[model samples]
Target: MIHNPNNILTAGKPLEEATKVMVMVHGRGGSARDMLSLSTYINDKDFAFVAPEASQHTWYPYSFLQPLQQNEPYLSSALNVLEMLRARLQSDFNLKPSQIYWLGFSQGACLTLEFLARNPMRYGGIFGLSGGLIGPEGTSRDYAGSFEQTPVFLGCSDTDAHIPKGRVLETEAVYQRMGADVTAKLYPGFPHTINEDELKIVNSLISGQ
Candidate 1:
């Protein structure tokens, strides 16, 4: 009779046969089903794909540019959801952080960055589309952790209405400082949507190419 705030939808091979697990987070107003839909473009049956749905189809009800505290319990809850899923994968499925990958879009991308920043590790890969760190402009990150050379790919629109390019650049710099091998690409005058080139890059990342 109780309701869970997080609902997880899974695809691909089960945890036993699949050594790789991709955690896909959806943007604000997006569902776990929508996040799982991305698997259509990516052909990989060896990897397990999991997406977590946020309550009411939103992570936090404000711009990521806002102060971190402004996002409050909702943001914390969202990150906690990811943490739970990661822990389950490590415990139940006997998977390590290095075998786990993350891919997210828009608001979900920001969430991904924040979560990884709090819990640093050598993950398989990270792809963030049109998003960046969470907090106001010039917020002092001073985060204490290292990614240990994990590969991170960031793709953003130079003219995205929601996410400014400067934040993306700042996030890339932060990732590099945290010991991540970062690759950043900005499309000029691009809308808030993924393009073929980005998809191709994602495919390569997913395929470990």
Candidate 2:
């Protein structure tokens, strides 16, 4: 199963002593170690970071915008990995849902946002860099549950070749409707990568500022 705990990489404070836990999902072809490296930029001493390695270094075989069925069980399997990870963090580490955070980029960001949409709850924060919810142009997003004012940040390029601006706005709307305090920023002609401003916003969240 993709949920194997051994496949997860950890960094920063030990979970047992951490007051907050963050799950970092890596992009396509990225490794768990790569994600853990982001903890350096987050720079939160009291937070425990966890990142899962996707089988084959790819969460799915097709673009996230492809029809949901086209990605097959891979997409579902990837989501299950997050589900199990969350469960373990809560049960084993005794972290409440509000103490958990989520962050991802590109394909990984899509997966992370999908998981949050499917299973809504109060979280420390949710950061999606250069990505939007999965599925084609008009997929149904009738996800249920409230975020209880959980802070969420969506940052992407207005001209991102991989992620359309429209989809990012749609994602913001979905989260706002679900009661998340959403912040979306689209940079003009920005490349498909995270920017310094995005990092500053995330850092503010991590610092509780």
Candidate 3:
């Protein structure tokens, strides 16, 4: 496994006694610090946020729409980082999978979404902004396991140059099939960026019982 230290940023409370843990992933060409800033908007004094930095500021070399093998070891390594973090959090903090939330933007969003799909579990929640699953146009998505009714929110622009609307729809369908309570919104004419509506939806989903 890669030995890069995660540039984790924390908010709310310390992990030792936090009520919830949010794992935030930044997009390509973005740093952990960029994603960490979102914690200010998602001010939940009882929740702890952790953002992991990708090696060399990129998760993978090629586009997410490329053939599965084209992204190879890098993609696998990225997934391993998340899995390792999850295991560490659970073992060290006594936190259950259901209390861990995953959020990412753009390329990071694609990585997080794909990771959750491949390893379906009852997470605190999932928020993918302007991203979708990885693979070529006709790649099969036969992911197994169930989310156990975990809430997943996906917000993207209908005309996003990086993320296609069809893929967003497909991602929602796959998660729903896995029993996730998914809320997918496609903003019309919006740029490849997160909007207030998306943030509001995420805040509402995370700040609940």
Candidate 4:
């Protein structure tokens, strides 16, 4: 049996009754409940929000920049968590990939992007706040498949203590190369936290306003 270490927290409309879905992933040391709180700011009545909890409130134990092997089965397990949620949305709620959005912050952002890279498709949207693709600087990202014009938003401070701006740009380039509609914003001297601008963009994206 594949151990699923995820406890999903949901908000907004039930999946079966909603037209849209948002799979929210939390940062390291953050809970699914905390990720669900963002739905209050998003405030999309037609959307079903699902947040998956990490075991012990952490998806992996090392920095995203560390070697892939170092993260090991924990990283693979985290990816499986997202996959399981996506499958549930498809099987139980009958939602399509294009109706599902991926959103995350910090370490969660890294995991979200990594999973997306491995499985590219036309998603509703993707929000990566203060994060980048996994692995070290010289890691090869020869991911197959295409995003098919999926809109992706990546926001990070130019001097974030945890993320490097270059990595964010690289992620943008990779997604764009895979046919995604990429929008990357670099905030100068901004703190390592989500800003009003990011929230506003997300609300607009999810609301179609």
TM agreement with the true structure for every prediction: 0.95, 0.97, 0.96, 0.96
lDDT of 3 by residue, 1-209 (tens): 55253545666678998978999999999988889888888846678888888888898889999987898888988888888888889999999999899999999999999999989989999999999999988888899899999999999999999999999999999999999999999999999988999999998998774
Clashing pairs in 4: none
Candidate whose lDDT is highest: 2
CA displacement after TM-score superposition, residue 48 of candidate 4 (Å): 0.7
TM-score-better candidate, 2 vs 4: 2
lDDT score, candidate 4: 0.90
Clashes of each: 0, 0, 0, 0
Candidate 1 TM-score, C-alpha based: 0.95
Better of 2 and 3 by lDDT: 2
Reference-based lDDT, each prediction: 0.88, 0.91, 0.90, 0.90
What is the per-residue lDDT of model 2 for residues 1-209, given as tens digits with 9 covering 90 to 100?
Answer: 54354699999898899999999999999989988888888866888999999999999889989999999889988998999999999999989999999999999999999999999999999999998999999899999999999999999999998899999999999999999999999999998887889999998976873
With candidate 2 superimposed using the best TM-score fit, by how many Å does residue 13's alpha carbon deviate from the native?
0.4
For model 4, residues 62-150, the per-residue Cα lDDT tens digits are 99999999988899999998988898898988999999999999999999999999999889999999999999999999999999988
Distance from true location, Cα of 56 in model 4, Å = 1.0
lDDT of 4 at 67: 98
Query: Which of 2 and 4 is the better model by lDDT?
Result: 2
Summing lDDT over every window of 10 consecutive residues in candidate 3, give the lowest-scoring window.
1-10
Sorting all predicted structures by lDDT, with the top scorer first, yields 2, 4, 3, 1
